[model samples]
Target: MKRRTAREKALQALFQIDISSTEPSAAIEHVLEGERSDDYLSKLVNGVIEHLDEIDQLIKAHLEKWSLERLATVDRNLLRIAVFELKYEHDEVPEKVVLDEAIEIAKLYGDDQSSKFINGVLSKVKQHLF
Candidate 1:
């Protein structure tokens, strides 16, 4: 799968895991809907799950006034996926690409403000990391 598609699927799966407390494999399978499983998609979901606390802490640290829990479900999980890539997949994916992808995905799946909100927070994250 393309990385974009993988990210989208990962966001969906993570959103499920966040909202319903679904098992990771079950969430991934539900998102795949009989399509072939993807390595990147699995990596994203599992990576986010594995480092959830760290990822959340990173986001929480960057957030201006917003608590992690106050974030919309889509925004929160999408941030987790992007932050995972930014932290763990830095050698594989450029930070700019990760930020851009997160913004685009936010535009598609989040409120009108979500893309801007994601961009702002992730830019801070990139600065801190780099």
Candidate 2:
């Protein structure tokens, strides 16, 4: 699957896992809906889950007034995916590409302010990390 599709599927799976406490495998399967699974999609979901605490901490640190839990589910998980790519997958994908993708995904899946909000926080994160 394309990386964009992988990110979108990863976001859906993460949203499911967050809202329902669903198992990771179950969430991934649910999102796939019989389509062939993509390696990047699995890597994203599993990577975020594996590094959740650290990811949350990075997000929490960058947040202005918002707590991690207070952010919209879509925004929170989108940030996680972007941050995972930014921090861990830096060699594979450029940091700017990660940021741009997250903002675009937010525009699609998030509320009116989400893209801006994600862009702002992730800018800080990119600065801090790099």
Q: How close is candidate 2 to the true structure, as a TM-score?
A: 0.99
Q: Which parts of model 1 are misplaced by more than 4 Å?
A: none
Q: State the lDDT at 123 in candidate 1.
A: 93
The residue-by-residue lDDT of candidate 1 on 11-121, one tens digit each, is 999999999999999999999999999999999999999999999999999999889999999999999999999999999999999999999999999999999999999
Position 96, candidate 2: lDDT? 88
Q: Candidate 2 residues 1-130, lDDT tens each? A: 8999999999999999999999999999999999998999999999999999999999999999889988899999999999999989999999989999999999999999999999999999999998
lDDT against the true structure, per candidate, is: 0.96, 0.96
- The worst-scoring run of ten residues by lDDT in candidate 1 lies at 121-130
* Deviating ranges (above 4 Å) for candidate 2: none
Q: What is the TM-score of each candidate against the true structure?
A: 0.99, 0.99
Error of 2 at 24 (Å): 0.6
lDDT score of residue 92 within candidate 1:
98
TM-score of structure candidate 1: 0.99
